[model samples]
Structures are given as C-alpha cells and as structure tokens.
Target chain A: MSDTKTKKKRKEKPPIEEPLLAPGHRACSGCGESLGAKLVMDAAGPNTYATCCTGCLEVFSTPYPESAWKMPWIHSLFENSSAVAAGIEAALIAQGRDKDVNIIAMGGDGGTADIGIGCLSGMLERGHNILYVCFDNEAYMNTGVQRSGLTPFDARTSTSPPGKRSWGNKTTKKNLPGIAGAHGIPYVATATVGYPNDLINKVKKALKIQGPKYMQVHVPCPLGWIHPTDQTIEIAKLAVLTGLIPIYEMEYGEVTRVRKIGKNRRPVEDYLKPQGRFRHLFAKGAEAEEELEKIRQIAEDNIKKFGLA
Target chain B: MARPRPAGYVAEPGSSKANKTGSWRTEKPVFLHDTCTDCRICVLVCPDGIIFGADSIYDADFDFCKGCGICAAECPVDDIEMAPEVR
Candidate 1:
C-alpha cells in the first residue's frame, strides 16, 4: 500500500527543481499576487526578462539588498514599466537577440489601470513584443489599501470609506482587458490565482504568440479585501464562479474563447459576504440592498457578455 | 581581503526560509497522511514553499509554514485539517 501510494504521489508531483522566481521573498503570508506572479514566472521560464512597476510585487521581490528573481528582472517607475519593457525589447532587437528572449512587464491595478495605462497603451499600439501582466488585487494595497481605478463598486477602501454621505467607491472596476483588446493585441487573457494550471497555460500560450499580448490576473489581497488569509484562493475562485469576474481569451480585439462557469454558478453574495470591503452591503436594514442588486446585475451582465453560462 | 563592490543590483537572492513566519498563524493545518490521496495539489499551491516531501510521505515545516491552509483547500482528497493554534 505504501509503495503504491508513493508511486502515485511521485506521478502527480510537478517537476519543479529550479523555479525561475526563487522562493524567499517578503510577500504577505497568503498573498495571491506573489503566488500568481510566481506561476507566471514558472510558465515563462528562465529565458524571459521581466519589468515591474513600483508596487507590492516590486517592493517585496526586489528589496535593495536581496532579490527573489533568478531571471533578469528590472524595476521601473510606477508609470513606466511597459515603457521600460519596450526599451528592453528595442535593445534586445538592436543586439539581434530579440527572438531568443521573452519580454514581460508586470504591475498592480493602481499602476496598470490608472497611472501606467498611457505607456501600456503606447506599447500595445506600437506593437512591442512584450507581454503586459496586471495582477489586479482591486486596490493600491502597498500604500495602505487605497482605492484605485480597478476597485469594485461599493467596496470600502482607505480612501473610499462608507459613511453618511457616501457608500464606499461609487465607481465600477475598469475593463482593462477590454481596453487592451481595443488596442488589437495579438493575444489577451483574464485569469486568477485560483486556477493555477489555467493561469500558467495562458501565460505559456501568450508567450508563444508574437507581437503584443496582455494578461490580467485577479489576485485576491487578504489585507485589502479583508478576508481570511487561507481563503485567498477560495475567494478568487468564488469571484469567477459567481460571474463577478469572467475568465476568457481574446485575439486581435475579439474573444477567442471563454472559460464557462457552467452548472456550479454561485450567487454574487457568496463572493461579497466574505470580503470586509463589501461588508457594508450586508449591513442592517435594506438600505444597501439596492447596491447589492446593482452588483448582482453586474455579475449577470458579465455572465451574459462573456457567455460564461 | 576587502574589495570595492559595484553599485546597483542585488548580488545574491535572499533566503526567506531563515525567517520563521509560523508565529504569525492563528490556525494551523495538520496533514493526515492516511487520508491523503497523494494528489500533490497542495504541494503545488502552497505559497510559502514549506510543504515538503515526495510521494505519500508529505509534511510541512512548522518553522516557515504560516498556516495559510491553501494546502487544505486545494487538497483533492481533503486530507489536511486546519486546527486552531493553542498558543
């Protein structure tokens, strides 16, 4: 029995001897962003060069004296990671080594959706051979959980607190993938940390395609979202399962495939109730029910729009 | 012997294993090898990289395991159990 079990385990285990991103970085205990980034790195492999914007990933992975990256990595300014990646790609082409290496630029929602969108748009429009990855944790988590352009509707943040006059962030999450798709990139995909295999496969697929590519991965922030540290993966999965976040792939401004939620579709409440940022929606009385209805409608719209059902 | 080093760039990768982050846990996951199906899903999903062991004989290093229970949640066999830390 023991021998059989051992054999089965060995077969199931992944061959991960030398990870591109070495283990030993200063990320939070259950940070999905770091884990998701690690998955992306593992998929991209050693021959890839990555550029990061000033955010949690940049701060934790490449702290001045120490770095977790085993591959060539660069830390660019908050609004210029894509620009730096473009420059790197241009330099690689000048050396006639462009085809040999994969270029990746990564940033959080704050950097990607807000501050860095211009450079990102320029890189896409210019058709740079780089993959832009946005690890959307929904807010600016590194700077004490402030509201960003990607922060969901009615969600509480340090800047968008719920009080008498206001009811958290009044804005909806920006459609970053849509914006990237509008640039007519070669490939675009949306993934989350919950589905590691899918995320890895998407990264691998994106890397193989030439020209500009974009992948937006939903990384659940335990600190910012105010959920149990262990439930990071669970919460991320729930976001997709509830249709609040759609998983799909696009090519040249058109969606090529959609990862359907199918029969196990969950209600939006299942995703919102666990997060403290959305706790106000579940407060006393039916005052916030209207907001809850609006959120449900958003999910329904995503389900219909992406054909997730 | 002393030598002047070049400025910029980290020469060596920092090993976070030296920092025992287990104290931050309010709950801990206890692995039940008997019930474990040897799927190894937990090993792949663990963010801390503390869960170690090849095949059926799997174990977590309490010194570094922050008890995220990602292993438990990802376990296809439901072998790992999350118990509250006494201390």
Candidate 2:
C-alpha cells in the first residue's frame, strides 16, 4: 500500500465555481451575449440588483417559470430597464441602503440604443447611481434579425437585405458611447466579449464609481451574424483588431484609456469575410469594393479619433 | 382548484438549472489534462458557465455544457478537443 498517495492528496483545495449566472439558460451555444452577461454579473458579484429589458438576455435567461440570474433581478418592458433601475435606486436610497448595493440595467442594442434611448438618457441626465450595460449584437436579434440603430453600415439583416440596388443598411452605427459621454457621466466605457478580463475590469470599475455609468459590450450572435458557433470570441476579437469597434473609456466627458491596436491592426476583410451579415460586402464587384473601402475609412477614422495607432 | 398565483412573479433564482441544456450539443469537448496549464481561459470564455474546477484539474459539467467548442478553440495550450458526442 502506498501511503505517499494518501499524504499527497491530503489538502488539495476545493474547486471554486459559483457563477452569478446559472446554467440551463436558453442562449444559443457560443452566444456572445450570454457570455457578456455572465462576465458582467460575475464581476458585479452577489450583492447586486439588476434589471433587464425585453431582449435576448431577458428572454433567454428568464422564461415563464425559471430564471438563470443568481441575484435579485427584474424583467420590465422593452424600453424601460433604465427606468426600473432608477426606481430601484431611489427606493434603495430612501431606505438608506443604497451605499452598499450595486445596481445594473441590462439590455440589447435595440433596447438601449433605439427604443429605450429616451429613458436611458433620462437615467443618465438625472444622475442615477446605476450601471447600464448594452450588449450590442448589432441588430434586433430576439425578434428575427432586424435592423437596429446601432447596426453598422452595409451589414445585412432581414430588414436590410442587400439587393441589386441595395447595399444593406445605409446608416453607420450610432455614436452611443459619444452620446453617453456627452451627458458628463462619471464613467463610460466600451468592451467586447472576446476580451473577458477587460470586460470584467470595466464592469467592476463602473460599479465602484458613484452616479451613472455606461458600458457598451460588443457581443457576436451565432444565429444572427451567421458565424460558426465556436468563433464567437474570435470574431469579437477580429472586430477590435480591425479597429472597427474602438475600446476606450471616458470619465466626465474626457477620454482616459484606449486599447491600442497599433502595428498589429488587421484589415477589414478578415473581419467582414467571416460574418454572413457582411457577406454582400465581399462580393466581387465595384459596389463591394466601394462599401469595403468605406468600412476601412470608418476604421481609420476611429483609429485617428481615438489615437489607437 | 387553480394554483395560487401572486402577480405572476417567480421567487426562485437560478431555477434554469433544471432545463438540461446539455442535450443540445452534437459535439463534446474532451480535455487532455496532461497538456493543460492553470490558465482558466476556458472557464472564463464558456458561454454556459458550466466549466468548473481550479488549477489544472478543470472539466466541464456535462449536465449543462452545450458543447460550443469554445474551450477547445480558445485553449492556449491545445489541451482541449471537440469530439462527436456519442449516444
């Protein structure tokens, strides 16, 4: 009998695995949105209260009889997660328990950048002590792929399908981070699902600050974007490396930190070719070249504006 | 008699654990622990949050893993591989 085996195994530390988001959620495999939510929730920790708008997160995490959230969470209307969070903040303040509680409002791009913009602006303007996270997958994913205000230029959706005369969506992504910063909030940042550590850091940083904070996390959708399920993180990284989705932070209307792409910056085609939504942009024609050049210019503009080089 | 419903609200948190999402997988990840480092990158990137364990002893909970192959795809040391799920 080998007594050394028993002695060596005497004190191995127990595994620590307590996710704030429980399993069995209906989010698709390799769903970037769910990963983003889990990262955010894990960062916020157990002593948090959250409100989710009616979008992919809310629908998938909380069906009629079950909820995946491990904290006190509320599901409200499609356009009022911010309002619900504001109300919760007010109630907590009146009860003198606001200082110890972390409040978060979660939504998809359609809920945050489009339909919910009014309430979100109000939440920011009124200086509510909360963090609002917009998981931007670039379209209205829960309701079949429809175009959203935050959808990037020339990306095809059900509503913006490319035809002989059409080049998908005509408008560029809305300046959401800029709009949030213009309100002069305490903290505003952008993150992506590919970089989990960075995403967690931003969420933790936002919770520590007082007053309103905003974070827009770029989440890839396997079902909607039509990329391979395993490539969610890879595609998300491509978005940043190509300098399209600028990762930066603002404090009180001033830029503080920007994730530099520098010499490792990649071309837009590496990103666009992988996504079916951007497939039309890669067609062998003058229109495709024109659209790609426009997308490249947009990335270059972002690099120049944020000093990402 | 009808069940007593109070304003259509759920009191239980994390109840989705009963849904058994693992059945959705057509492929499952197999870990080669010998080549594994203690990076925990696979644990962090898992969308389902079902990969558990600390250090180099990590493994996925097959009860909920949707087998997205992210763990294998993102493994820095090539410690994980996606294999076809066997009946």
Candidate 3:
C-alpha cells in the first residue's frame, strides 16, 4: 500500500457514526454554544439522554414540531435541568438501564452559574451518574443580553452598561469549575469551542467515569459580545491563548491537566480588542489604560494559577 | 406542512431536519479538496451537522448549512474557506 493509504488504515476511527444532533435548528450562524454542544453530543455517542435548561440551546433546538436531538432529550425549567437529569438517572437505575445510557444536563451560564446553581449543587452533592455541561457565554444572551454571574468584569451588558458611575459589570466571572471541583466530583473540566479536539476528548473521558462530572465550556456569543460571526472561533482561541480562560481538568478536587498556551501566548488585549463589549476599556486615555491593566492582571493571575507559562 | 399546534407540543424527534436554514447564511464554506487531509474535523465540528462523508472525502448539505465557519476554523489542514454569498 502507498504511504497515504497506510496512514489512513492506521488512523483511529472517529467516535460518532451517524449525526445525533440533526440540522435545521434555529441557532444563529456561528453560534459557539451550538457547535460546542454538538461536539459534546457526538463524542458522548447515541446512547445518551440530555436534559437542557430553558436557554438558547433549548430555544433553538426545540421550536415546536421540531427538535435537533435524535436521542432521548428533555427540556426542563431554567433552574431545574440538573434536577431533572437526576430524576432521569433515578428512573434509569430503577429500570436497570443505567449502565446502558448516559445522562447529561446542560444549560447556559445564566442557568448554570446563577439561577440553576442551587439545583446543580444538589445534583452534585447527591452524586448522580450524570454529566453537567455549562455553556458559558458569559451573559444571559437569550434575554436581551442581561448580566449573569459569569459575565466578566468591565463587560457591557444590557444590565451592566458603562456610565459615569459604573464600569459595566463590576465583578469577575465566577469560577464554576473551581466550584464543581469543590463538590468533590470525580471529573471537572474547562473547555472552549476553540479547541474541538480537547473538548471532545474531555467529554468522552468524563462519560467513562462514574458519579457526577462537570464541564464548563466557554462559548462566545456574536450578538452579545458584538463581534463578527466569522470571528467566533478566533475570539475563542484568543481567549485561551491569552490565558484569560485557562483550560484544565480536575479530578477529585485536584487539577490533573492544563492545556498549555505554548509559545504563542498572547496578551489579554488581543483577546479583549475583538469583542465590542470590551470597547470602552480601549479608549485612548489614562482611565481606559488603568482598567485595561486590571483586566490584563486577571489574565496574568490565571496564567500563574494554572501554570500556563 | 401544517402549523405547529402550540408551545408545549412536539412533532417527532429530530424533525428539525425538515427546516431548511441555508438562507440564513451571509457566507458559505467551500471545501478545498486538494489541501484537505480528510481528518473529518469539519464534519465533527459543524454545528448544523451538514457536512458528511468519511475517510478522506467530504461534502456539505447546503440546504441546512448555516455557514457557521466552525468547520473551516477547525479544519487542521486549512482545507475549508468561507466565501461571501453572491446573493
């Protein structure tokens, strides 16, 4: 056989056989959340049941008479997806089908970091055999871009607009992975749409482990972040490369792996400049520079904390 | 095609495959077969799941592809390019 043919023969097969998440749903063009969700679903394979909270994913995937999900999927209230998934797990166990099926609970940052946190905590504490995936778009994008707990500092959302007395959202993004790790879950991972391979691998690995697993995926929103739709992956990549969002996995309350930034590590400005939500911090003056310094320091802190250097 | 009954009602699982979302695209991805490595990353990463084919060959179903260049971006070989739609 030729070299190319031999290489093809030696290549490992892709996990997904048929598309589990079908097309024709209403997700916006270049939606990082939808893309990341599909990657996760594909990696988890067909023998999975997903529970989605009332957010962009649920809205787009199930628009009456239409559903993108081919497998068993449930849409629950904004704050009860994890609880619903726990119920599903209980039922599966009752029927002795727990080993054959995987349970997944998914939600946006608004649902995961804020509204749904209480139920999420219960699900984690109960140690259900479920994987909870939070698509962190940083704001409540479905509801006119209101500020959510995951909204980063100095971001301009509808509820956190900049003014003379206010500098956008006056708080840092919540460390959800850290919170999940504190729950003593067997697996906790932070991923982004920028790295599909890493995201897929982590999802696959998480599914193999028993008990609760939490994954926080950074998904950029073009409408909320005010970036061109085409730059979705670019912005996501910059977010990780700049060390603003450290990609890592924790097992049993200890970080076991960190996706390094490598030689192409960039400054925080490179990640912040593309998104218009951070535009106010880029004005040609001293105040803007000061705020920029603070944001840069956050990235520096992440680098040091995760040992990304 | 009948109108949807109400908010709580659902048709069939994966019925969204009937909704053609191609018109939403302002740009479309064109696969460069020459530079393609057949890694299937585009097929794997496409949000719409419109890209198909196995091994070293692939094609897209433009009827549902919303032109989310996620495929183009994730293509390791830089084999997919996004082009502005003529319309």
Q: Pick the candidate with the highest lDDT.
A: 2
Candidate 1 segments whose C-alpha is farther than 4 A from its true place: A1-15, B1-8, B14-23, B83-87
Write model 1 residue lDDT over A1-309, tens digit each, in one string. Answer: 456665553445554353555555678878899888888987898899999999999987776666778778888599999999999999999999987689999999999999999999999999999999999999999989999999999999999999887789999999999999999889999999999999999999999999999999999988899998889989999999999999999999999899999999999999999999999888776778888999999999999999999
Give DockQ for candidates 1 onward, in order. Answer: 0.40, 0.54, 0.50
Model 3 residue pairs with clashes: none
lDDT digits (tens) for residues A100-125 of candidate 2? 78999999999999999999999999
Recovered share of real interface contacts in candidate 1: 0.34
Q: Taking the true A–B contacts (Cα pairs closer than 8 Å), what share appears in each candidate?
A: 0.34, 0.79, 0.68
The predicted structure with the larger DockQ, 1 or 2, is 2
Model 1 TM-score, all chains together: 0.92
For DockQ, the strongest prediction is 2
Best by TM-score: 2
Q: RMSDs, each prediction?
A: 2.8, 3.7, 3.7
Ranking by lDDT: 2, 3, 1
Ranking by TM-score: 2, 1, 3
| lDDT at residue B11 of model 3 (Cα atoms) | 56
Summing lDDT over every window of 10 consecutive residues in candidate 3 chain A, give the lowest-scoring window.
A1-10
> What DockQ does model 2 achieve?
0.54
How large an RMSD does model 3 have? 3.7
